[model samples]
Target: MKEDIENTSDSLKETRNVFIGAKVTPTQKEHIKSLAGQCGMTVSDYILSRAYNFKPKARLTKEEAALLQNLDDCRSDLVKYISALHGMSTKQRMVMFN
Candidate 1:
């Protein structure tokens, strides 16, 4: 519907222009470049699209939203575990490991 499309469009704010550096192996860069070309999006756009899974016109049902939230929480837990194993302080570490 037109109203849904308009609402979706309004929700997405324009990305700010900023510089962020990433260190990637040559192979990774080449793969990203090739995929970006195939998808007809710039390398940055392609990467961003995959990372955000952005679709201007797509909508999430309530069940999908709940699943997404659960996945996000799992990701957070994984990050905490990785951090604890690396160098994060014991005090800041989560008790889930216990």
Candidate 2:
């Protein structure tokens, strides 16, 4: 179908599926990892962002970091609750709503 073909093309555009490998000294690897940590990104993500000419933002403050962690926990809890809802019968769901 044309729709299926278009969907595949759109998905391909959305993802970077290419792999780039490099050789680096242990010290260099550590430095790159440290920089990535400061940007709150994985080493690979940091490298890719830099390669694409994107500037990495400064690290978050302790309070900001704590808030982000709490937000992540809340998001996880919400996902679990939604998944549980999917297993409920219609009557049970109506009971829940009421």
Candidate 3:
């Protein structure tokens, strides 16, 4: 999806003069806008992504992304640490985790 975003922007950045208009009820417009907002996309982006068969994911805040990366690093470290505890029983491992 990230790659798709970059590619789409690169391909269309200087050539986005064509308009693709559609008629919808005011209620429908609001609903579409709400859906776009929920995914951190503009209405046009939400529509384009959907049209291109890409599943939209919620955009993350910078802080949230950093925290997730940190958590992943910690989990990797924990796996390495656990492997070094070769004498520990499986039961001990489970109990310790709990």
lDDT of each: 0.73, 0.89, 0.87
Better of 2 and 3 by TM-score: 3
Candidate 2 wrong stretches, greater than 4 Å: 1-13, 63-98
What are the per-residue Cα lDDT tens digits for candidate 2 across 8-88? 867888665778999999999999999999989999989977875789996998999899999999999999999999999
How far residue 20's Cα lies from its native spot in candidate 3, in Å, is: 0.3
Which residue pairs collide in model 1, if any? none
CA error at residue 21 for candidate 2, angstroms: 0.5
* RMSD in order of candidates: 17.4, 12.6, 7.4
Question: lDDT tens digits, residues 1-98, model 1?
Answer: 75575567568864547866689999999987877776667888777666556632335657988999999999999999787677856654565456
How well does each candidate superpose onto the true structure, as a TM-score? 0.40, 0.47, 0.48
Candidate 1: misplaced stretches above 4 Å? 1-15, 54-98
Which candidate, 2 or 3, has the higher lDDT? 2
Model 2 Cα displacement at 31 (Å)? Answer: 0.6
Backbone collisions counted per model: 0, 0, 0
Candidate 3 weakest lDDT stretch, 10 residues = 9-18
| Structural RMSD, model 3 | 7.4
